[model samples]
Target: MCRWLAYSGTPILLEELLYKPEHSLIDQSMHARLGVGTTNGDGFGVGWYTPDGPAEPTLFRGTGPAWGDDNLRELAHSVRSGLFLAHIRASTGTPVQQTNCHPFRHGRWLWLHNGRIRGFPTLKRTLMLAVDPELFPEIGGSTDSELMFYLALTFGLERDPVGAVERMVGWVEEVGHRYGIDHAMQMTVATSDGQRLWSFRYSSERNSRSLYCSTAVETLRTMYPENPVLQRVTEGTRIVVSEPLGGLVGAWQPIAESSYELVTPGMDVVGRFNPQSAQAGLPVPATVGANGG
Candidate 1:
């Protein structure tokens, strides 16, 4: 439905990932091999943190194909960030407006998603009503992606990201069930707090979107000992994307179905993620724990 990339570590121009890679995000916008569509021309956005800038990341967005935006190309070449997220949107039955573009933000957090709710229009009101009234006004678009973000916030994302997400999804399924819809969700979502990056891939039917996290830079370097590109990116750097940017062998690892990942300053962590249906009364929204390598 869409494509996105999240990056951390080694301050470098945005083009390093947006345009320079063999199958860069820009290239993906035109020829996405894994996305449902070959072109994601509806809109695009990017948010990034600068060492000396404000605590909140800077954002740039437009209601046109990323590959055709002159301003985006110029900015990508000029701005440098160690942490950033970029998205190319393919409308999932939503109007293609600048406001609907992804890499959505609130406070210092940025978010993007790559799938759709199976029957969002049918369940929009019911699902949205569940969002905290205080957080409701912050929603700027009609896409299920944005609603899902606020849902997570309503469930306490700032303090418990994984748990909040589980709760959010659980609540969605709860609503969908009330309407007799079987597969109400499909998502591969990425979010960042200007520090750590978190990503999740899951679906109601157990078959979710495609997502991958970069192999550890140290391991890639060891595997491609003669490749200078491997040496250039630091060991702490990480990238989570909707698909592999290129055909670099051993450079990407598939995230498991119904799973989530965390990229912190110290290490990368992965953990199980399953729907915690309210009907089942499971302890899903509880503090979801993880293990790091």
Candidate 2:
């Protein structure tokens, strides 16, 4: 499992989202309130885009706990961006290596996942065989989460993100079921093209890992009138996270299961996900049985 956050809108220092909150992602790295584990210290990563740079994002990832990393604190304070994705990892079985860290990058895209493939060793070979060869060499990690990212890319995630992701999940579940592993895929993924952000929350089982998004800045300002930080953000800013970074009640909303949310230049759009099946070529079933049984 892992903890992550994605931000889109007005440019702000990374610290504002990764450290300033009372229970920020760094805090969750040591004391998560809702994650299966209390700590997500296996490794961490952050990706951001700048105005003058190429469309590709700048990324920093390390195989160390976010809570104890001095470099992380220093970098968080100095970097600022209008869009970014940060992740704190809790390795399920993968080794704690830089290549295995989250916020995996491709050409102009960055991706991170918060869940796992229930039986990765048994399914990895098959899944790896399915990725497009041109995109295959770019994969730098052994994590199933990273594999899923490339699979979606191979399936055309950059062009039709929601469709591509749904297809990737469908393939995951299909392979899991083939191996007699029910509900083998669990995920809350955030992906960006240095412009728009797309996030998905779903598992073969109906009970997916927790994922949330912040309320509109204007709404939060009205709800917590006395909070000065809320006042600083513009009306269009939005944040999506694996958990609420702070204890600000009403500041976050759970994303619906079997759906995806899109964050563009000025607005956020959410809709149900329906991936066309690779086999039947029709909408695939996104539901899973209890406990993946």
Q: How accurate locally, in lDDT, is each candidate?
A: 0.87, 0.87
Give lDDT tens digits, candidate 2, residues 1-293. 89999999889999998998888999999999889999999999999998987778999999889999999999999988999999999999999999999899998899999999999998887778777777889888799989999888877788888888888888888778778899877889999998899999988877888999999888888888998877777888899999888777888999999789999977889999764554433222233222232
Model 2 residue 137 lDDT score: 90
Badly placed stretches (over 4 Å) of model 1 are 277-293
TM-score of 1: 0.93
lDDT by residue for model 1 over 110-171, one digit each (tens)? 88999998888888877776677777888988899999998888777898888888888997
**TM-score of model 2 (CA atoms):** 0.93
| True-structure lDDT of candidate 1 | 0.87
Q: Judge candidate 2 at residue 183 and give its lDDT.
A: 88
Q: 47 in model 2: Cα distance from truth in Å? A: 0.4
* Steric overlap count per candidate: 0, 1
Query: In candidate 1, where is summed lDDT lowest over 10 consecutive residues?
Result: 284-293
